[model samples]
Target: MADKKPDSPSHEPPRGPILVPVDFSAHSEAALLLASDFADGLGCKLAVLHVVHDPQNMPGYYARMAGKKTLTRMADIAGEMLDEFMAKVQKRHPERHALHKAEVLLVKGIPVTRILQVVEKEKASMVVMGSKGATGLRHLLLGSVAEQVLGLAKLPVTIVKEQPKY
Candidate 1:
């Protein structure tokens, strides 16, 4: 049997799936592409995660848009969006089978906190996310999810910028 790494006692190349958090942005699609490549190269599973976070000003956006008066059904709406997003990903890259069957996970919380929670819960080998980069006042106020994840994640974290040509 092959020996396991000091951090991973499973004797597998990766102890857990590669957790990828997407906000349904162009950069996220790019991150998914690159994460798929990493998963393929490492022979590990992929867990596509979408966190349903409502901004302070727009709470329950999904529930409201879905014609519900409450936030209770937001998870259902988010699931639908995740489904549509995955379908689009499959359509966009018909050749990438890794993206086709990735495990989908959806949760409701703040993006950064939820992301870190997932890494520990899933025991993710790494995290790959996209960054548009926050600038000026936005940087000081909201900061960037990638930067926060990079600073906090104990495991490897890869931040990919959107590459239109890629």
Candidate 2:
């Protein structure tokens, strides 16, 4: 009779898509580059997510008059902004196509909550985001969206620390 041997761990590599949340900031650009590197190394896809929070919920007089006209104007502005951002990124990183195709998604809601929603919808294996570092009393008082998302999301999160000098 032959003795049974323990099974060895499979050598299969981790495979899945990577999602990057962008706010069209320099920090976001850094995070996108990081995500691109990871995606290229892992042979995964990269998706860019931008959340356009509903202005109605924002604390201000704008919330009081969130009528059709106001909403339309806001949507138009958001669309233009997103378009410009995508164009700039595309222009800046022409070599990005070699790594992986990009996706631009525009959603509305609380930034962190919307991000989590997209993560679930996309079935992303991991998320990359930029941390706009807040210091001292500001950090303590307002808190950070990156930190909030880091604590809340179920999947792994890669936080790209912004340059402290900037």
- Highest lDDT against the true fold, candidate: 1
Candidate 2: where are CA atoms >4 Å away? 1-14, 56-72, 98-100, 163-166
TM-score each candidate.
Answer: 0.83, 0.76
- Candidate 1 worst ten-residue window by lDDT: 56-65
Clash pairs for candidate 2: none
> Which ten residues in a row are the worst by lDDT in model 2?
57-66
**Candidate 2 structure quality by residue, lDDT tens digits, 54-154:** 65644442333345456555545566666777788778888776223777788877889999999889888899999878789978986787898899999
Candidate 2 TM-score versus the reference: 0.76
